[model samples]
Target: MAMHTLIKEKGISGINVHDWTVLSHKTSILNSQEIDNATNELGIPIPEMIFGNNFLSIEHKSGFKLEFKALPALAMVDQSSKSSDLIKVSYAREWFEKRSMANQEHITDVVKPYDWTYSTKYNGTNLSTDKSLVFSPTTSESIDIEQLKKPDPILFYDENILFEDELADNGTAVLTTKVRVMPSCFFILLRFFLRVDDVLFRIYDTRIYHRFGTNTVIRECSTRESSYRETRSRIPRSKGGDLSLLLDSNWVSSQLPEKESQVEVLTLSQA
Candidate 1:
């Protein structure tokens, strides 16, 4: 599918709007010779014996938008009966309503859009948290791949989230690499139900774009849009390698929220 369809041409509204998903692919174990062939195909100098090494190549994509909207609540009256819970109802409604009405003036000035891009060689380990740890070029070094260690669960890769905005400047692009072990495998010899023989390498990219006219006072909107494209490449194992690995190269759409509905942006008012 096209990014425009997933994100929509008009765009959505809200302080935070983005789409994230994981793509899985079929894989095969590569020998030294095979690794060289695949490396040449990729056109980039990848680690030798790609499967033997602990680190796996990765690519991840994340995109979102921030939209500010005006919300007006006119003439709100308390209609609750004289019950214990009724006392706070009026106050609560008035507080939120008034706050929403006040935010209409400076929403644009306060919310600025951002993007992130950071990349480096990453160590793959089975840690408690699924968070990415980035290493600068100066500190990039290979570690003993626990994936190659015997018996004790070979964690080929770990799932992680990179909190770039939490620790960097606006419009910064964060790029990171990580790998995960896929349960499926194809053995050239035995061809039995195997473990982490096949793995998927990914590169994730997240970006935030501001919608036009949102910086103005008269406009109000908030929504999320997403689009995805995937390609499946079948790799040669031992024999029967002549068979095509290409499954399908197509984009798919998601069933998110409806397009016509309106979303409200809520915030606390100091006044």
Candidate 2:
């Protein structure tokens, strides 16, 4: 199936949005295990894995705009040292609605209609009652083309990690990558999904900054978009691997087409 169609199908399907914020000191190390544990406890699936250019940093900041095709259950597990009384949770749905209305008005006010970016900033405390954490939007004011320049403290990539893999008769081919996200990135994406039905699509334009201070933008979006015509033809068996999660010899068998008639076995194996 075409990638575009697949995306549309997933978006049109019932997908839920769950926004999250993590709190940590600037110098603290982000424990991947802790994050995994939290998500696991909530029964939310952890991302398959993380991939990026620089994995190590002192002040690591990242965010995600996820479009889940189905509304997964959400649960919050607090691991902070502070007492629960100190933690406050605030829903920004009203704030988001107001900002969106203003943006629409602003668009109509412009003489020459061009895309304008807006951002908000919220402290972690705004997110919780304890005032321990806040999130703010990063926005740019309306400036003429000549005055336009990338904002300082610019983020070259979005915090969301994309996972892509193809299951084949024998094995699967997987690829993981990160993309740059714009300010108001999360909210804008969330609104889009809320307004649309059955089809959710996102474009992440790749931007590269060379050591010489040169910047390049790659417009081809979607890390999952790939040419599989040739690769698909080369797969050996249409029904090869076992589906069993166990490693023992007892395997589940399933039927396949005549030409590809083979017993599908489930086996415990590592990816």
Candidate 3:
């Protein structure tokens, strides 16, 4: 691993390693200009915190590539007004009608008709060719939960939030990515968690695992969700945690039901 102290890019720090397989991660807070550019390009109002300049990508000499970027991730957000999955906040109807009747200058709290919560199902973008692909309907080669439980030393570990919003104080919508490199393998998790207070909790997860010196990469993707009340019922009545637990995405995600899950494999050329 090398530092940006030797070679930097536009006030951004990057971790760079050169080999047959290269890993690069760059993150920097965007300025007002950059935020405006992102907003214009995306054609949507930007979130409260959009890391427009952040990205995590891998490139192999053998035409295998994958990347997680803020722009593409934000593009996956459901901005449709007619979408069935729109969060049903109690004040949604009143907020919509008021925004339509009131002058743009007079509008204070609410802004647009889009999914203010900014729920997204994006995992990551795989730029590999057709030759390096496989399909799996089972979890035979999925991310080994037990393996991750081992106390192996993590060589490289980093996490970053691509975007986040407070949902106008209703709840939170955030997307984050975590990467850990161990002795034998590397693992990546892209997570999108959404919570609407007293409404529902939703989580989308993407897990990728690749062992060193192997050409195979296993990816498991899943979505889980449950209503706020249902999630609350899971708490034990005798020793129940407080409502604060519901504010935690990690806790809420575990309490939800799995709606969909799939596993796939990508076969890359030996590095």
lDDT, model 2: 0.20
Q: Tens-digit lDDT track for model 1 on 175-226?
A: 2222322222100000001000011111222111112213210111222112
Q: Cα lDDT for residue 70, model 2?
A: 11
Best prediction by TM-score: 3
TM-score of 1: 0.17
Can you write out model 2's per-residue Cα lDDT over 1-271, one digit (the tens) per residue?
Answer: 1011111232121111112221111122225865566455545333233121111111111222122111121122222332122111121232234336646442122222111111011000111222322222223221122312345232232332222212112122212223222222211111100000111111122211111111111111111111122222333465354323111111100111111111111111111
> What is the total number of backbone clashes in candidate 3?
0
Q: Over the stretch 215-237, how does candidate 3's per-residue lDDT look in tens digits? A: 77788999998776678888777
Candidate 2 lDDT at 267 equals: 12
Best by lDDT: 3
True-structure lDDT of candidate 3: 0.70
Off by over 4 Å in 1: 1-104, 108-157, 164-179, 183-271
**Candidate 2, residue 75: how far the Cα is off, in Å:** 15
lDDT of 1 at 215: 21
Q: CA lDDT of each candidate?
A: 0.22, 0.20, 0.70
